[model samples]
Target: MNLVERDEQESELERIWSECGAGKGSVVLLEGSGGSGKTELLHQAAERARRGGGLVLHAGCSPAESALPFGVLGQLFSSVPAVEGPLARLQAPNSPLAAEAAPHDPARGAVAIGPQLALLLNEVTATLLELSAAKPVFIGVDTVRHADAQSLACLLYLVRRTGAARVMAVLTDDTAAHRSPFRTELLDQPHTRRVPLAPLAEAEITALLARQLERDEAERLAGEFHTLSGGNLLLLRALLEDHLACGGVRKDGYGRAVL
Candidate 1:
């Protein structure tokens, strides 16, 4: 995608990424509808952090595995060699010894924190925080609405404790779906910044088309494309490709892409 109408959002992310390197941590939530480019914007931010010598840990969540305990958290830490011991402990299957170690809240009972979850959350947070002592750490999670409960808990714990450290967590949420309670809590924090990504305008659509076609042809097609796609980049790109592939026709390409 061309990133045609996201200059302001990109500038904001650059500022936040720079601040992360200066020992000021903040949470950035990329809120958008499907195909509004949240994931692309997130990758751009992560690349910026990486270029600044920041330790970038990235993860993408899946709805199919949302019930799997600590799935997203495990993905983030799995790449780090230093946290292997704690990561191994977390990756191991459920056992009675681990179950007995977690202290439950008296009023809430055993289901409140789950068995051994609190300990794992603390260990991961502590490890990441300690790592940030030497350099900036960037944690990016995409499609966070589908993150597992335990992973969300650990993320919330780490985010709440990031005030004084060089640790930044960038997350993308699909606004079309129901927002997770944990994700909502993250956005409510004072240091959290929300970047709401919107669909592209007609002019931006024209520009995108102009990338491949002539200016006159792009201008001529922009309105119909915009009307059909509602300015969604993903749909627009597919339509363009279909148009080109089908000898410049828009016969059922969008529907096929949607399918």
Candidate 2:
């Protein structure tokens, strides 16, 4: 998307990068509608952190995996070095789901045992501290609203303890969905920032069309697509791809797209 009209969001992410490097870990909740480039911005920020010698961990939440305990957390830590043991112990012991859960998510049992939860939380804190002790760590989660309960709890726990560690937790979720109590609680945390990405303006869409087509065609497509996709970049790109694939480039003199 080339990050069109995302200056404020981009700047905040850059600030997060700087703060994470300075050992003042931060959490940023990026809120946006679909096609608003929330995930793309996070990916760019992760790339920046990686280029600056930070270890990057990413987890993508989905409905199918929401019921599994610690499912999202495992996706995050399993990629980092030497954290497998702790990740394996995330599921509650003696729970039926524990036996049936995948190997990566030992805490798959729905029921939570107090001691087991404590152990898992402690392990998470210890592992993150150790990982960030030597270098910066960037943890990014996309569609975090669907994150499993156990994982969300551990994330909230870790977030509360990140002040002195060299870590940055970047989470993205849609704004239109039913509000999650966890998100409301997360917003109240200290050292956390919520950045919202707004919809693109008509001119921004025009400029994007200008980048892809000639002057006359750009004007035509910009006007046509602003209506077609309502200034949504993702949808606009998809429409263009479809237009090209179906040989819809031939336009009338009045500049209407020929079907």
Candidate 3:
């Protein structure tokens, strides 16, 4: 779904990109309850990054998936191709894999994976820096509160080390749930910005309906929608869909429902 009206949030994201995309490290925290549009906001930011010719890496944290080791890292690795230069840089001079590698040697693969993971992360950071060398790189994470402990640790490492590289890491989470340790850590760090998302205002809701429905129809339903949704965007959208399905019609001036 298109983000209805969130100029403030959009501007905040743009600001992060502008300030941090210079190959300098930056972190942006977008905290809100479920259905508050945080994920949509991140999606918008990712689009911005793509337009600027920057690579985008996306990972979502889930309770069930968190237990899987290297879940996030695995996702990241699969998204981007291997960085040969970075891998070479990571290999030790005396390492066996550094000497020669058989095509399908599992042992050699195991020996290389550890250092390669480190190098890969560094290369990812470098790639972000390279993309933002003239513009900015955008890294987006959703449902961060559900992120695995390992991913959280790596994120913390990124926050601490990313300043020299131009990368903006945007993390979103449902604030109503248990607070994320990563969120707390990011807040404590320097150069991190936090934005809390609340429900939409009545006028915004009105504008949204106007875009979705006829003016008169929107006007007739606006008040009732506001009453039903209390400006909550998710609830409002769901309620509207439900209303349409239930044969709810637009009311005329006298408040009579016209089928």
Give the Cα lDDT of each candidate: 0.79, 0.76, 0.66
In the order shown, the candidates' Cα RMSDs to the true structure are 3.8, 5.7, 8.9
Stretches of candidate 3 above 4 Å error? 82-135, 244-259
Candidate order, TM-score descending: 1, 2, 3
Off by over 4 Å in 2: 5-7, 92-115, 215-220, 242-259
Q: Higher lDDT: candidate 1 or 2?
A: 1
- Clashing residue pair totals per candidate (backbone < 3 A): 0, 3, 4
Question: Which model is ahead, 2 or 3, in terms of lDDT?
Answer: 2
Per-residue lDDT of 43-153 in model 2, one digit per residue for the tens? 999998899999999999998998777889889988765767776655546544343332333243222335556665677688889989898999999999788776776
Instruction: Choose 1 or 2, whichever is better by TM-score.
Output: 1
lDDT per residue (tens digit) for residues 1-259 in model 1: 3365577788888888788788889998898889888898889888887888889999999989876766787799888888888777766788432343232442222223544666766777788889999889999999987876666766777798887789888899887766446656887888898889888899988988888889999999999988888988788888888778875656574567677
Residue 75 displacement in candidate 1 (angstroms): 0.8
Give the number of the best model, judged by TM-score: 1
Model number with the top lDDT: 1
